[model samples]
Target: MKAILIEKPGDESCMKLGETAPPALTPGSVRIRNVACGVNRADLLQRQGFYPPPAGASPILGLECAGRIAEAAADVTSFRAGERVIALLPGGGYAEESVVDAGSVLRLPDALDFETGAGAIETLLTVFLNVFQLGGLPSGGTVLVHGGGSGIGTTTIDLVKRAGGRVVATVGSDEKARRCRELGADAVANYRSEDWVEVAKQATGGRGVDVVLDSIGGSYLDGNLRALAEDGRLVLIGLMGGAKAELPLGALLSRRLSVIGSTLRTRSPSAKAAIVTAFQARFGADFAAGRIRPVIHRVFPLAEAPEAHRMLKASTHFGKVVLRVRDDER
Candidate 1:
């Protein structure tokens, strides 16, 4: 098997591709001949000596992958060998093959190609779980998504709009704002040039939004609070800006607002499986129904995983960047 191994955390140049033994499948786990994998920002942070793979996880960098089941453990009953599936990984997605708990392996919708499936689990799970499950996004609610051109951002825009919510998005430039509008955002604000909270307020007719899905932490944390309506929920998924921030405690109390943080990669297997199951039961039909679809901006071959990481860091892409492990996987 070929894998991208990070001998030590450093710059993007540190990711090295070399031959490695394939991991053997364990009880309740399945071996996947990886067809595709998604490049996540956390992968870059990990390589730069910031984020580390959780305990007991593979040292490799990928967070989600789509592939065929080469072997299914005896303890697994619902899935079998040769099934096309997408699975969430605690780590080790940046390889030719990987293993995952069967409970985390989801059958790919026939309508989806492997590249799309490969990029699905991580961003979609993060958005669905935080925005809807934890953030309490309601049907007919007004929703604001920061970093709207990001993979998770675009996914949130699609899900919220399809669920009957009005979408407002904040982006860095005019180009991303255009993409956000095309993706069903009722309004788009250029966060780099304008005050997004004001734009959000105007878009919502001065009532503010019912929910805010924010990834950039730090100073934006206070702004997120300002953008929310009374009883609004603010879900923080990343602190791309910085970890520490001056929060508006008075506003939080006065408006009865809620702020919750989420990270899918570090969650326990049972927690990941619970979200997989919950999404399967509720939004699975959306995939087949054509309401929610994977949005991939670019696809790079597996060996060029470093380039994929660079692309993600550039923040030029409007949606997900997926690595094509094998063109025939679909």
Candidate 2:
């Protein structure tokens, strides 16, 4: 089977396509003929040797994939061979084939194509867990998303609207702000311009937002706390800007606010399974009914993964960038 191997990673140039032995089937796992794989910032980080796959995980970079089941382990009962599915992986999605835990495998809705499915799992699950599960976005409440044009950002916008919540988002450019609005964000602000915290306040009529999803961790942390409403929750999902930051403990004590941080890839298998189960039961019908949709920004052939990495690093694309292993699959 063909796979993207990071041979002692230094850059995207370190990622090479080469033939390797197909992954052998294991109990409680299923082999997928990967039709498409989603590229993530973590993948880029892994390529540069900043992140490594967890224990017992494939050394490859991808975190999620969509495809048909080639084989199912003996314990797998709910899913079968030849079934079309998409799955969350701890690692090892950037390949022609992959073996995923049956518990993490989900049957894609009939209405969704493989390309969209490839793009769906990581961002949607990440946003859902942090924004709604942890941040507690109640119906009719206001939520603010930083990096509004990012994969997680755009997905959070849709999820917030679907849950009957309002969204205020910060993007780097006017074009991205427009994209956020198109995804049903109630208000958009340019983070590169004036203070987005002030803009968010005005958007919410000075009430501030109930929840905030922030990936920029350095200078934005204090500002994110400032932008939160009384008793609001702030969920930090990434440290894209930088890790070190001076936080205002007084603000949290005075406003009674909470700040939480999470990453999906580093989670335990049971925890991931639980998250997937919750999402499945909550949104399965909506997905099948064609209400919630995956937002795909672009699709590149599997061999051009380095270009995809470059594009992700450029931070210009909105939504997810997928690598199509089989064009006909979608």
Candidate 3:
């Protein structure tokens, strides 16, 4: 099989299309002939040797893909060969095929194309797991989301609105702020030129929000706490802005705040399966009905994975950047 191979852990120039052995199918897993795959910031980190795949997992960079089941383990009864599906992978999605745990695969809705499926599954599961499950965002409650124009940010805004909650999104530019509002954010703040903590509090009448969905990590920790209402939860999912910070134990105790750190990549298969099940139960219908979808900023071919990485690194995109592995007729 041909894949985007990394000659070394470095810049985009290190990647190139090359041949490699196809992955062997494992029990309780399915082999997918990938049509498309989603590009994520984690991929870039992995390429630069900052992140490594978990033990016994594929060393490939992609985390999610959309495709058809080329084969399925006999124990997997819910899905069969030739079924359209999207899967959350531990790795190995940047290829012609990927073998994934059966429990992590979702049937791709007919309403969506392969590219959309590729783009939506990862971000949807990430946001659902962090903002709703871990953060415990109540219906009609308000949440402050940092990096509002990101794939996770846009997905969070859509999901929160559908769940009857409010969103205050913080973006780096005015255009991103406008897009966030159009995507259902109740309020949008240009973090580059505005005080996001103030905007978050003012959006909820100075009471602050019930949750703070943050990806910026350390640099935003103090501000995230200030943006949250009493008893609010701060769900940290990424470390885009460095990872070390001093915790103000006094404020945390006084405000009764909870801080949670989460990541989907290193989770056990069973744990990931549970998250997938919960996401399907809650939002599967919404996706099948075309009521919600991922916002795609661009799509590149499989061989151009290097270019995709460059674009994501530049942070100029508003949503997901996808790689088309093969043409989809339907």
Candidate 4:
């Protein structure tokens, strides 16, 4: 099988398309002949040696993929060979094939193509778990989303709107702010020029947002708290900025605020499966109905995984970047 291999932990130059042994099918899992895969920031961090795959996970670089099931273990009855599907993987998605736990697999909607399916599962599941499940965003609630042009940000805006909530997004440039607005964000703030905390408050009539979905970590911690309404929740999914920060205990106590940290990659298989099930139950119909879809910024051939990493690291893309594993006629 062809897979993206890293020669060392460094720059994009470290990655290369190379041949490797195919993964063995495991019980409770299904092997997929991957058609496309989604590239994520975690892949970059792993490439640079800052993040390592969890124990027993594939050392390969991708997090999500779309393809047809090649084989299913005896214990896995929900999927069968030749069925179209998308999977959230622990790793190994940057390849011609992937073997993943059956619980993490979902049938790809007829309305979507493989490229969109590759991009959708990870971002959609991430947002759904953090914003709605963990953050407890109520119906008609307003939430603040950082990195408005990112895959996670774009998905957050779309899901919040579809769920009868509003979004106030923070971006780094005017173009991203405009794009966020087009994606159903009720308000947008260019963090490079405007105070996003103020924008979040204003967008919610000065009461602040009910939830804040932030990935910036330390640098935005104080501001994220300020942007939230009383009893609001701040969900942190990434630490792109520095990791260490001091929490304002007084403010937290007085306002009854909550800070919750989450990551999908390091979770147990059962936990991940539960999240997948919840996401499917909540939004699967929306996908089939075309009410929500992944916003793909670019698609690269599997051989060009290095270039895909470069684009993601440069932070120029709006929404997900995908890798085409093969051209499936179906």
Candidate 5:
């Protein structure tokens, strides 16, 4: 099999298509002839030696993929050979093939293409688990989501709107603001030129948002805390800004706020499987029903994985940047 390998751990140039042995299907798992793979910021970080794959995970860099099952374990009754599926991986998504626990695989919707399908499951799972289940954003509640034009951001906004929740998003520019609004954000704060705390408060009628989904930590910590309504939930998923931060503990206690930090990649397989099952049971039908759609901005060929990394790092894309492992994966 062919997979992406890193010759060095610093730049996109370190990535290359390399040959490797095929993965064997483990009990309760299935082997996929990968058709497409989703490029994530983590992949770039992995190549730079910042984010290593979890123990016993594939060394190749990729987190999510859509493909057809080529082999299945006898215990895996939900999926079988030749079935179309999408699965999240601890690593090794950028490859010609992948082997994943069957419980973690999603039956691909008939309406979705592999490229976009390859892109959305990870983002969807992250948003669903964090925003709805963890953050407890009510159906009619208001939310403040940072990086509104990002893949995770777009997925978060679309799902919130479809679920009847109001959303306020923060963006880097006017164009990003316009794009976020077009994607169902009720309001957008141009963070580059405006105060997000004020924007969030005003959008939610001066009380503040019921929940805040933030990727930028430290530098934006104060604003995120201030933007939340009383007893609000703040789900911190990334630390793009910095790690250490000084917080107003008095304000947090006074407001009865909850701060939760989370990440998907480092979880146990059983934990990930539980999330996959929960997501399917709760929202699988919506995806098949066309209530939610995968937003794909660009697709690069399998050999161009490095370029895909470059594209994701540029942050110029509004949605997912996927790799086309095979033209006919759909």
Candidate 6:
């Protein structure tokens, strides 16, 4: 199988398309003839050697793909060969084929093409797990989302609106702020030019937000806290800003705030299975009916993964940049 091979960690030049042995099937997992792969920041981290695959998982970089079942174990009763599916993989999605746990695969919406299917699964699951499940954002509640023009940010805005909640988002530019508002954010703040903490506070009529979905940790920690409503939960999903931060213990205790952090990659299969089940049960119908849809920024062929990484690192694209492994599959 051909994949995005890294010859040197931390160098974009190291990312080249090369052939490697296809992954062998796990006991309970099924094989997917991968059609498209979703590009994520984590893939960049893995390429740079900052992040490694979980124990016993494939060393390949991709975390998700959209494809058809090429092989299935006899024990896999719910899915079978030729089934159209979206796979949430531990790794190995940047290839022609991948092995994924049967429980981790979801039925791809009938009308959704593989590129959109590839873009949809991971971002949907990530936002659903962090903002709604962990952060406890209620219907009609107000939420603050950082990196509002990002793939996760745009997905969060749409999900929040559908759940009867309002969103206040922070972006890097006035133009991106407008884009976020057009995507259903009740308010948008330009963090590059203003104090986002104060912006978030004023946006909610001084009450602050009920929940915060933040990927920018480190220095933004204090500002995130300041933007939170009393008893609000801040779910930290990434440390894009840096890992270290000064703690505001007094403010945390006085305001009864909760700080929670999570990453989907290292979690056990069973744990991810639970998250997947919850998501499918809750949103599967909407997906099938196209009530919720994917937001794709661009599509690149699988061999041009290096260019995709460069695009993402430069922060020039909004929503997800996808890799079409097989043009005919979609």
Q: For candidate 6, give the lDDT of residue 222.
A: 86
Candidate 4: tens digits of C-alpha lDDT, residues 1-330: 999998789999899889999999999999999999999999999999999999999999999999999999999888989998999999999999999999899888888889999999999999999999999999899989899899999999999999999999999899998989888899999988998888888888899999999888999999999999999999999999879999999999999999999999999889999998788789878886766899999999989998999999889999999999986543
Measured against the true structure, the TM-scores of the candidates, in listed sequence, are 0.97, 0.97, 0.98, 0.98, 0.97, 0.97
Task: Please state the error at residue 142 of candidate 6 in Å.
Answer: 1.5
C-alpha RMSD for every candidate = 1.3, 1.2, 1.0, 1.0, 1.1, 1.1
Overall lDDT per candidate, in order of appearance: 0.86, 0.87, 0.91, 0.93, 0.88, 0.88
Best prediction by lDDT: 4
In Å, residue 236's CA in model 2 sits off its true spot by 0.9
Which residue window of length 10 is worst by lDDT in model 1? 286-295
Write the residue-wise lDDT of candidate 2 on 241-288 in tens digits. Answer: 899898789999999999898888888878888988888777767866
Error of 4 at 130 (Å): 0.2
- Superposing every Cα of model 3 onto the true structure, what RMSD results? 1.0
Pairs with steric clashes in candidate 1: none
Q: What is residue 267's positional error in candidate 3, in angstroms?
A: 1.0
Off by over 4 Å in 2: none
Report backbone clashes per prediction.
0, 0, 0, 0, 0, 0
- Candidate 6 lDDT tens digits, 1-330: 888887678766777889999888877789999999999999988898999888988888899999999998877878889988998888999999999888788988888888888988889999999988998997799889988888899999988898889998988888888888888999888887888888888888898999999888997898899999999999998899999998889989999999999898787888888999998787778888877877789999998888999998998887899999987745
lDDT of 1 by residue, 176-242 (tens): 9988898899999997789999999999889899988887889788888889999999888888888
Query: Which regions in candidate 6 have their CA more than 4 angstroms from the true location?
Result: none
lDDT for each residue of candidate 3 in 220-277, tens digit (9 for 90 to 100):
9999998889999999988999899999999899999999999999999999999988
Candidate 2 TM-score versus the reference: 0.97
